[model samples]
Target: MDFVKKLPRTSSGHDTIWVIVDRLTKSAYFMPMREDYKMDMLAILYLNEIVARHGVPISIISDRDSRFTSRFLAVNARGPELVQETTEKISQIKDGLKAARDRQKSDADKRRKPLEFSVVIFSAALHGWYYMVFVTTVGEEYDKVFNHFGYVKCTT
Candidate 1:
């Protein structure tokens, strides 16, 4: 989560945008906020904008802005267990993202393979036609030259 400050004020004088992103889904929510809102107001906004919709997140990653550093926002938890749980969640998210990327790349490769093959075949045919034109124009011994190079007998 982060804040984008110093934006142009709206008609109601809101000048900050709360930028909340769900890391697992890469989804984002932008909420307009006033610059001078206190801890309580911020809490209410958080509850309404985020918690009310997504329930609760497993953990939050933030820039630790002054609003977040306030005592009211702090949560007490067992240190080792919190660390382990956070680590496991992060590892799973990473693995899922990697697998998604790999699948996307495989699909892209499948789509491109036929196009690449077509280009190769088209260029070969063009080259063969060009060679035939050159041989015919240069001399009457086209068959001898073609047979000597063994190009006419070549198969796909």
Candidate 2:
């Protein structure tokens, strides 16, 4: 959560030490780094020290900085076709039905659930139900779970 431009052992204008941390356990990785460290070198260090030594972790949290956000840094930079494939048709069918179901679920939780709205609610529920059944039937047809409710996919 903290970064300093200068360290006592290093020169005044040398590389920054990118600090990563696990807040719950208070463990940290002190990495002496320049932002411009090429992709290959960075991958080597990460695999050797972090992945190899410590093993895969459930999650890693980092600051919103260019070093983390750079397009070149992403391992899977999807091609335009793949990106379009995921967004345009693949996601829309799942998302649209989910939005309707969630609204119905919220409405149903109220003390005065509407009697006349039962047909509307049933149709919405069926859409959600069908999505799950289709995904399961198609053998994990979609990578994402239906009705994830704003869940963000972090593939790291």
Candidate 3:
């Protein structure tokens, strides 16, 4: 996302073009606004016009533009809730989390397996059973089968 500033004013009082693009898909939104618009206005506009429609992005890359500086965000966009951090401190935290985060994702991918039966797992917990076996048929021929598992046969 970037801004194209100092253009001829439109009849609608819009002179700046807010160029926001999705890097993965190459889709774009060329929003029109005034060059003197405040950061608070811009942030709200971004949330409504961009995030509301597309969803929150994982990250955003910018060109270190003056308008996007942390000072502007800290003062205007995020007041008391957000604590300003030094660049070095931010990088240190990022480096610390990177390895653990990657390992967790890798472990999750390797060990993941789909459930065979959804209802049986839930039902087992509800009934306090260690195991459940569905018996569909019963006869004299199946007597040995029932006896091995210790399941009582029902006539009805």
Candidate 4:
């Protein structure tokens, strides 16, 4: 659906790459190209590479570069009936996407619950997130407490 141009020229003279993607299936194609190719040549390339395999697309989303816009019009003008079918297909895809989004939201709603809890302060002193008591008042602090819990000794 877009070109990555101005690449280091290959031995075959390709300096651009056309990156095409199918949104629904998430499949992609990277076709090498010459940067100087005209609109008509690009159109022919598209017909051969894309249309030959996947048929006409439901719609194309592009950045509206002049080359792409011209080619888009040329491709779209193939027939009125085809255009109408493409339009309907586009609408159907949009509706399907909306339905998928709604389903996901419904699933998430089923899992949603309010947080309910309480904090119990067992220690008289709150040192950072952990609660502990510093031992300025302890009679045998090292033997009675801290030493048994090694690293916890520093915390107190």
Candidate 5:
């Protein structure tokens, strides 16, 4: 599980795409840009805004856009192939995520039947058995912790 960020052009200007992912949990946020921003400004934005909130990630991956690689390039000479390769890599990541999510849901559904099994196995115990089964079978809702837009709303 790695974190990846992408800069996509939005209606406002160039927006930063922030992706935070764990094994089965994933969240994406689109952050709009301020005026006259540079690559250094972006680094600061990533460090202060994104990393500060999520803590340091294991790895950070991004496309070879000018905003990411201009400091390494010589004047106007930048690699177009790098951009193409990075774009393809991102697409593959998106597809993999979709598959992982679907599989997780399927497995959860399959495991849910153990609640019914507990009834037969623990027929002598009435009160505590069903309570334990109910708590164990229910997964935490991601929506309660994060919104569709990836903002962390404090429920407490």
Candidate 6:
């Protein structure tokens, strides 16, 4: 999640956009907001727009913005060791998700190979038909032009 700031203000005085992305699903949400929104306002917006719709995320990744750093530091101060352990677990989960996604992609590609091959064959056939028609048309035009110029076919 991140913020895109310093945008041109809208008519309703919004000059920033909150960008929330789900890494696993590759889904995203963009919410317009005023630049001066406080941390509490941000939390409320986050709850309403993200949490309310998708439920709570397992982990959030964001840039080291002051608000995020302050909030994160405050939360982790209670159990720094736990934070380290959680980070390791999150990394393992991310790796597993990556492997799963890769396997899914490979399976999908295997399933789609026949369809892709058929599409290529169909396109080649269509192009070949068009080329034949074009050559035929050009041959007819050449004959007409030669006949107009008084050229005759000679028989031996």
Clashes of each: 0, 0, 0, 2, 0, 0
Task: Give Cα distance to truth, residue 113, candidate 2, Å.
Answer: 42
lDDT of 2: 0.56
RMSD of each: 15.2, 23.4, 18.9, 14.0, 20.7, 15.8
Most accurate candidate by lDDT: 4
Q: Using alpha carbons, what is the TM-score of model 3?
A: 0.36
- Which stretches of model 5 miss by more than 4 angstroms? 1-71, 74-79, 113-156
Mark the regions of model 2 whose C-alpha exceeds 4 Å error after superposition. Answer: 1-14, 57-156
lDDT of 3 by residue, 26-100 (tens): 899999999988999999999899889879755555677555665666675653334454556788899889988
* Model 5, span 40-138: residue lDDT tens: 987887778667887874644556544555455555355897788888999999999999999999999988655322211121223333222223334
Model 2 agreement with the true structure over 46-148: per-residue lDDT tens digits? 6776678667755445566445645554755768866887688767988989999999987878755333211111113333422112312323323354235
Clashing pairs in 2: none
Candidate 6 lDDT by residue in tens digits, 1-156: 899999999999999999989876899999999989999999999999988988975556566554786687787786879889989999999999999999999998988633211111111323331111222322234345345644443322
lDDT of each: 0.70, 0.56, 0.70, 0.75, 0.55, 0.71
The residue pairs in collision within model 6 are: none
TM-scores, all models, native as reference: 0.36, 0.29, 0.36, 0.36, 0.25, 0.37
Worst 10 residues of 1 by lDDT: 114-123
Residue pairs in collision within model 4: 1-19, 1-20
Q: Write the per-residue lDDT of candidate 4 for residues 1-156, one digit (tens) a residue.
A: 899988999999999999989877789999999999999999999899989998875666566754787777787777978879999999999999999999999999999774434322232233444444443433434445444543333333
